[model samples]
Target: MPTPDATRFTVLDLLDLNLNEQNALNLRCIGGRKGLSREITVPDLNRPGLALSGFYESFAWQRLQIFGRGENAYLKMLAESSNVEIYDKLFSYPIPCCIFTHNLAPSKEFFDAAERGDCPILQTDLSSSEFSSRVLRVLLDIFAPQTTIHGVLVEVYGIGILLTGDSGVGKSETALELIERGHRLVADDVVDIRCVNGSVLMGQGANKVIGHHMEIRGLGIINITHLFGVGAIRDKKQIQLVCGLEEWDANKVYDRIGTEEMTTEILGVHIPKLEIPVKPGRNIPIIIETAAMNERLKKMGYHSAKEFNQNVLRWLESENARALYFNRDDFL
Candidate 1:
């Protein structure tokens, strides 16, 4: 699925991405300005070596084409041999763009063909391997299935816990307590979640400007980063657990024993879920903290509730065995 608020992801969107230094693409367009608006539909990439060699049997013309030094060298050979027909044949399909790695430049003839085909040609300074890896990673993140959720995302005890509930269910208040108690807040109110690699859900604030800002019931708005320093806020985190906060009910039965596991689905991926009932003197923040630690223990192969149940079962069996021995005919 596409992100709730985003439109088509074009080549211009990739260029406009504000990535950090380590993951920056450093791409610049050298030709075909009118085709920069072309949409990139796929997450995968193609090297275009086979297409350049006139073997277009299994050509992946829809993906972003990465032309390494070898492909450029072949193109140079083609230019020398006046084999210009292959360029037109290659651009015949609506390829997203042609990316030249290692600061490689295309010949005048190739640029003419790209202009004629209305295909954008991009250039990068990194080597073929490095650029390919970086661009692929970026593309995967962009094309990943995404959706926006109404909740607060926080990191407590090194686990991402999504606090969800009705509008007036004290979800934000509980998250505020969590933040004040030395935990880190990923986002407040609106969380943009993306399912990366089809398994892991990465969550971040919907808007960067107001991501760190939180709106309490009466406090209006407060900046978490400024109030708690930079250590109390993070840009993003994986959604490992979901805890739904609800008003405490007098008649509804709650799960006292944790033998059975519960889960909730988001973006078609399931994660551990807990429904927490809130009332006065409930100490929800501490409970959430403990829940985070318990989740970690579960990941480490320790099940507290299950172990306790097994111990109780063993004790009952021992008691029954003792009663049988004492009441046996031979013993009596």
Candidate 2:
């Protein structure tokens, strides 16, 4: 599901985004202040090159119309014709905004048309290609499917392992130990998982304020950053493996051989899952670290369980062939 606030995204939010260097859009309002509240419903951009030539068929008016150098020149040519009717027709559609890259500015007549239609006109210092890539990235993340999961997300052996199970099942405790072992903690209690690019599950804290804090049974609440320093915390990580910490059940027939792989679905993506039973002296952190390494091995096409089973089958086949040869009438 798209984020609740994604539907309400406006041109104002794009201007107000807190982006860092390289990803910063450097966008500013150049005209049509009344249209700043216009909602951006799409994650794509339109060049408006063909639209400027009066070819309105299949015109993507819903997207952010980009006016690069070529489009700006065309608009200038249209302005010289003493015809403002084309600009009015362009603004008649409920376009989110018109963004001019390379810090390009439209003519006075263009701005007048935008003001009449209440369509915001934005400008950026970045080039057309750079601005298009940056804006599309930000919009994809905003429109990605997101859900809040009650679990602790941590990185073990450079692999993101999500600790999930019933409450008080030692999920947080296991993550705390993993953190003590020098692994990074992504999120403690509430993990906001977003499915990016339709396959990768990116996990981070739901709330930035309480992200690095963990709630222990006896210790109440503790700040992980202060306890372990900033090197032990991560802002976000891709969830590669899921380790379900459940109370050790004697009757449950757990897979001892590890031959049959198990997986669980989160946001339509199937992630490799391991149900690690929790009990005294189990050393859950070590098991998770090992599981992370094993997952890496599996990704490299080396499955330990399958390899061992193949070796055993080879030995059994050889022994059976020798016995049958020795039991033949001529050999006896």
Candidate 3:
């Protein structure tokens, strides 16, 4: 099942007094102006506070006064003072603002000061590294969700297959074979994939009939559309399958039957998958085409292995019946 889009909680969203109290066991947001309090609080790993001019001048100076001249305590004092000063500056910037804090809890003094027009406080359950990763991913997904990549995509026997592997993995070779078999080629060499409607993955070729050409190591590049005619190309295809080519490992046990289904995940959607081991004399293109046909058969409710096994069992039962219930004298 597709997971819901990662819910992003801003400083303002989490700052609600009611929601804060509800999830208080997990998170605690305190202080900030009550009436004008919906301030933006995002978890930013970039030390926005450190960049502020004179951040060390105000809070750092106060902490030194409170603790006096203790040289060993300076590091602890500096960290705490910087966090406070950062929060102070973030609150004054804009409503929807965020700053990151680590390890140390906000002191009562800081929270009390924040209550008097200070910024919203956000606590994260993730470790420093983990929180940074999650925050960056959410930000990237929300702000920039699309990217273009160069690859090949094909549709065989009604199943859309995307072929991707190392530079010399024969992706284009296999696509060419499928096209020769009368199946349409969707995209070749450079396929553009986009996640539209959050669930469906649509793939198309680049400009200049990217779906109409194929490249071979010895032959260089050949145009399938011109040679094989217009029936050889497709405008676009839904990505129903993904085949990742990897160097075959002798020690690794690979799936040999279709009883279990394997899937490849793209943009959080799981598409049917198959691992075709590569080796000298192996007809990988034929294997992929057969796999697509098999998938189509499965969709039509026909299973060759299951049917053959059932027939074998029935034949054995007939032999047993002859041994158990038949009489030689009756036949005579």
Point to the candidate with the largest TM-score: 1
How far does residue 216 in candidate 3 sit from its true spot (Å)? 1.9
User: What are the TM-scores, per candidate, against the unseen true structure?
Assistant: 0.94, 0.92, 0.48
**Cα lDDT tens digits for candidate 3, 183-301:** 88878777766665577777777655344777889998888888888988887788877877656889988887566678877777778887777777888888888888887887799
Window of ten residues with lowest summed lDDT in model 3: 60-69
Q: Which lDDT values do the candidates have, in the order given? A: 0.91, 0.91, 0.58
Candidate 2 per-residue lDDT, tens place, 225-289, comes to 99999999999999999988899999998878898999999999999999999899899999999
Runs with alpha carbons beyond 4 Å of true place in candidate 1: 1-5, 325-332
**What is the clash count for each candidate, in the order shown?**
0, 0, 7
Error of 1 at 120 (Å): 1.2
> What range of 10 consecutive residues in model 1 has the weakest lDDT sum?
1-10
Better of 2 and 3 by lDDT: 2
Per-residue alpha-carbon lDDT of model 1 for 184-228, expressed as tens digits?
999999999999999999999998877799999889899989999
Given candidate 2, what's the lDDT at residue 32?
96
